[model samples]
Target: MYYSRKRLMDDLPEEVTAIWSCTNEKCNGWMRDNFVLSARPTCVQCNSFMEKGEKLLPVLENANHKQSK
Candidate 1:
C-alpha cells in the first residue's frame, strides 16, 4: 500500500514586513518587528546589534506580546 501525507492548512502567502537584521556580517540573525520586546532589539543568536530592514514572510501574530503604552 502507498500513502501520502498532506498539510492540514494551505501555505500562507509571503508579505513584506518590518524586521531587524543582525549588523554582524557573519551572523544571519533576524526578528519580526512586532515580536520585539524593546525599541532597539539585539540579535538573539550572536548578541549583535540589529538594523531595520524588510523581509518577505508569512503572516503571523504574537498574541502573547502586550504592547507598551
Candidate 2:
C-alpha cells in the first residue's frame, strides 16, 4: 500500500483536525495533527493505538458562538 505523500495529503479533509482517540475505554489518549499531513500518531498518554479505520469526531470550532447569549 504505497501512497504518494502529495496524494495522501490531498485525500484527507483539510478540516480534519486531530487524529481519533484510542477506543480503549481504559486508555484516554489522542493524537493531534494537521490531519492533512498527519500519517499515524500513537497515543503516548495511554499507549493505546489508533489506526485509520478507527472512528473519529470532527473537532468543532466556534462552539462559543453557537451558545445563546
**Best prediction by lDDT:** 1
**All candidates' lDDT scores?**
0.86, 0.53
Which ranges in model 2 have alpha carbons more than 4 Å from their true place?
Answer: 1-18, 35-38, 51-69
Query: Which residue pairs in model 2 clash with each other?
Result: none
lDDT of 2 at 9: 60
Residue-level lDDT of model 2, residues 1-69, one tens digit each, is: 786898866565544444457667888766443342335556667756665443344444543443332
Mind giving the per-residue lDDT tens digits that candidate 1 earns over 1-69? 664443323456668999999999999999999889899898999999899999988788889678861
How do all models score by TM-score?
Answer: 0.77, 0.34
Question: Model 2, residue 54: displacement in angstroms?
Answer: 11
